[model samples]
Structure formats: C-alpha cells, structure tokens
Target: MPDATQDAAARILAAVRAIPRGQVAGYGEVARRAGLPGRARLAARVLSQNTDRTLPWHRVLRADGRIAFPEGSAGYREQCQRLRAEGVAVVDGRVRRELMAGAHGDLDAMVWGPPPR
Candidate 1:
C-alpha cells in the first residue's frame, strides 16, 4: 500500500541499515546510495517519518559529521546515545570521523563502478 515516495524512502532506509556498525554515512551519501542523487532532503524526510524504530536511523548524519538532531532535543540525546553505544565517538554532539569506521567505497569504485569506467 505504500506510495512511490514511501517505497523510495523504504529503499533508502534499507540501504542505510546496510551500513556496518561503527560506521556512518552522510545524508547525501544515503540518498546517492539509494539511487536518488541530490535528494538528501528527501532522505532526511524519510528518516524523520520512520524515527519510531525499525531502522538504524542514527547512523545517518550531516556531511560535517554532526548529528542532524538538534542539541538538547530528545532525538539529539538519543542519537548521541546510539552512536556512543555503537562505539562511534561523539563530541559536542558531533561524530569524530577519525574515531569511526571509514565509508565502504573507494574513490574510483564509488564514482566509476567496481570494474572502473
């Protein structure tokens, strides 16, 4: 019964869940991996709507490594808690990239496919 947008969002969430523990992906990255390039806002919207559970939603963050949830908000606290639980270092409500796992794809492979362009 899901609409096209909802189905797309679900696909994005599934991609997000594929992110291994201790790693994180930016909103834009999630969108791109979900086959919806330049749709970071849509990714965020989907995540927001499904925050009630069933997805590893906390693994998605802003491009600058900051938790997208606003500071002092319930979601922010939950995000920090979740990241910390996953061994992802969080300071000042932001993730420290050096302390977390790197992204999955390599430069050439990411842009040109695994076999190269």
Candidate 2:
C-alpha cells in the first residue's frame, strides 16, 4: 500500500484504540476521527486487514448503527457478544441510540482525545 494509505490505516487504528470500553463508533465516525472524512469504507477495509487484535475492532460499526457481520453468523454473534459485554445495548443487531447520543457528527475536532460529542 502507498504511504498515505498506510498512514491512514495507522490513524484509524489509533482512533479505534481510543474508543472507550462501553462506547462504540460508526465506521464513518472512526474515519472522521482518523482525519479522513468521507472515508468510512477505507476504515472498514483497514479493519479487514487489521493484524492488531488488541485494537477494539468490534467497536466499529455501520453508519446505521448495525454490525456489519451477517446476522446469525459466528462473526455476527461474536460482535454482538463483545458489544453487549461492553454494556452497549445491541437490540435487533443495532446498537441503541441512547448509548450513541454523544456521538461526533462533525469532523472539526480531534475525536480521539476526548469522548466524541
């Protein structure tokens, strides 16, 4: 991969690491936190190739607050289990909006420092 791509992936990983145990962020939100607006797909792609299992990969989700894994699949079950274990309500495969109320809808600030809001 190009240096830019590698750098972006590193940034995304850093942002993923910053997500608190009980909080989750959409892929788009993570991309924004990585300083790459409108690059949600890039974040997902980076996650697919992620080797650092220590990163909170499961805390990243679709923009609609849905887990990307197919429902009923092992990955899906794992994602749901991991999220619920973090106290993030996973209802019908979608995380509760109440838990995401403090979300960062804009990309003007560094989201990884303070909790997104």
Candidate 3:
C-alpha cells in the first residue's frame, strides 16, 4: 500500500501529465485537478522532488501565466526554450494569456496548433 506522500505525488504527477502538449496550466489549477484544491505549493513541492526527466514540468506556470523560476536562471531559460519549441509564445518570461489552457479560443489553438500569424 502506498503511503499518503506517495499517493499525493502520484495524483499530482498524473495531473501534470494530463496537461496536453503545447499547453500550460497554473500550479493551483493542477492542484485543483488533482483533487487537492488549495495545495498549489504541494504541487510545486512534488514537482521539485521529481526525478523523471520525461515529465512535462515546463508546462506548469504561475497563476498569472509567468514562469516561476527567477529571471536569468537556468530553469527559467530552459522553460522558455521548451515552451517556445512547442509553439507557445513566451514573452518576457510569461506565456501569452490567450495561449494558456483555459483561456478563450484555447481549444482552437490546442486542436489546430495556433492560427497562422
């Protein structure tokens, strides 16, 4: 039987994995979706302790759609690079609001890979 920590980590990781490619969700939203509402810090903590390189950690951002890493940090640069590789526009270290997972017309962008221009 898994301990509570393991269970929580599993739920958190699963929620993170559910975020589709080229899309991003806030830490709070991920926590909410993981059945652990109001535990955004737990989500961040679990992610910080993760060892799997395959996890899409870059797809998670702050509530305001900003990168959580400090500016000029390696993590911040890596996150910006990863997001841009997925066709997500990262301006001044923040994902464009219209491109966030729950934003308006996000379904169209997610399904069709953003409109040209």
Candidate 4:
C-alpha cells in the first residue's frame, strides 16, 4: 500500500489527468486543485516521478506557457509534439499564452479544481 504522501501524489496525478486535451494547467494550479496549496513543487516532483506511461504528462506547463521540461531534452521535445498534435500553438519552443487562453475555455474551471481551503 502507498504511504499517505504517495497516496496524495496519486490523487494529484488523477486530478491532472482529468485536464482535457488541447488544454493545459500551471503547476501551481495543479497543486491547488489537488488540495495542497503552496505545493506546486511537490506537484512537479510527483509528475517527474510518475512511471505511468498513459498519463498525459505533457499537458501540464509552467504558468507562463513555457514547457516545464528542460530545453533540448527529450521530455521537452515530447511536450512540444504533444501540444502541437493537440492543436495548441507553440512558438519558438514556447506556447503562446493567448493561444492557450483561447483553447482553455472556462479558465478558472480548467485550472482550479475545487475552492481552495
């Protein structure tokens, strides 16, 4: 059985997976949605540690629309490719915030899950 922290991380991953294609949420947003405010780094760490191949891990990004993975890395390339395939516009290796804004309707609902406690 997973420890409490592991279980929490799993739950966070589940919430992240719920974000639809063509849409992305910020790391801080994911943390807040996972019932762990101020734990954005923890959320990122959980995603990095994830071994689940099916998780749409590419759909999460920094708040500035920049890919979270390091530049020139395989993960960075994969993230760009995934976003492109989903019709999200990425320019100069960065996603345009305007494009993301248009793609993600109901912005608050898309990023934030429940009301923060």
Give the whole-model CA lDDT for all candidates, comma-separated: 0.78, 0.82, 0.87, 0.78
Q: Which tens-of-lDDT digit does each residue in 7-26 have in candidate 2?
A: 99999999888887887788
TM-score of 1: 0.79
Candidate 3 per-residue lDDT, tens place, 1-117, comes to 469879988999998998888889888878887889899999999999999999999999998899999999999999999999999999999998866765764333566685666
The C-alpha TM-scores of every prediction are 0.79, 0.84, 0.85, 0.80
Better of 1 and 2 by lDDT: 2
RMSD of each: 4.6, 3.6, 4.2, 5.3
Task: In angstroms, give how far residue 94 of model 2 lies from its true place.
Answer: 0.6
Q: Please give the TM-score that candidate 4 achieves against the real structure.
A: 0.80
lDDT of 2: 0.82
lDDT of 1 by residue, 14-103 (tens): 878877777778888788878898998999988887856768888889878899877999999998999889988899988876432234
Q: Give the poorly placed runs of model 1, Cα more than 4 Å off.
A: 98-117
Evaluated at residue 89, the lDDT of candidate 4 is 86
Better of 3 and 4 by lDDT: 3
Query: Which pairs of residues collide in candidate 1?
Result: none
